[model samples]
Target: MTPSNPDPDPYLTPGYRPGGATLPRETPPGETPPAEGGTSFTGPDDSHNPTDGWAAAPLTAVLVVAALVVAFFVAYAVWFVID
Candidate 1:
């Protein structure tokens, strides 16, 4: 007989937890981290992104902004003293 209150999902009941969501198996000895995004549910974390370590930070751009901020403060102080 079917359950009187049938759930929407046939494969997953209210309390079901899939094996893939369980903690990962330990690496035996000489193996690398488990495969990502193939048979496994998780892809590499952002640290493992394809673009990881691809570009240096744009220090010149940041320095330009920092210079502008310093100049603005200096000008404001000078004007305040002269006024």
Candidate 2:
């Protein structure tokens, strides 16, 4: 038979402390690290302004009122049919 393995299976390991250096080392002071693709949020301000257009509160209120009115009508119809 083959010699028994000393190290346990890495996949079967539990918790944060698996075996080796699983975490990234802290960046040095003043030195700018290279932009990590997708992970890094620091980039061109291409995001649209949230307050550029009409507020969502008005639209949400209108939708809520419409839904409430529809619900009331449905309840009324069901009550009428049952009566």
Candidate 3:
């Protein structure tokens, strides 16, 4: 013979509770719930182009050249002092 199930419905069993707080169906004063089933988001139309600002290639080239000039001067000074 099959053993009888103590709690046939696990949901109805004692000490077996569902997670999360129980929220009220009623909306707060001066606020209304959405009529639609899913969410509808509205946002501003803005550009997200990363290359909108100053050109990175030109800036990087200028910085590299400046660094090389400074490095050359430092090497010349060290050589002059040693020689």
Candidate with top lDDT is: 2
- lDDT per residue, candidate 1, 13-65, as tens digits? 33334553323344233334445657555656566547544244576778789
The sequence of per-residue lDDT tens digits that candidate 2 reaches over residues 1-83 is: 89999998756543324445443333233334556688467777777866666678988999899999999999999999999
Clashing pairs in 3: none
Q: Which whole-number lDDT from 0 to 100 does residue 5 have in model 1?
A: 71
If scored against the real structure, what TM-score would every candidate get? 0.37, 0.36, 0.36
For model 2, the stretches where C-alpha displacement exceeds 4 angstroms are 1-53
Q: Whose lDDT is higher: candidate 1's or candidate 2's?
A: 2
lDDT of 1 at 38: 75
Question: How are the candidates ranked when ordered by TM-score, highest leading?
Answer: 1, 3, 2
The candidates, ranked best first by lDDT, are: 2, 3, 1
Q: Relative to the true structure, how large is the alpha-carbon lDDT of every model?
A: 0.61, 0.69, 0.68
Residue 40, candidate 3: alpha-carbon lDDT? 52
Model 3 TM-score, 2 decimals = 0.36
**lDDT of candidate 3 over 21-82, digit per residue (tens):** 33454324434335675545556656774757668889999999999999999999999999
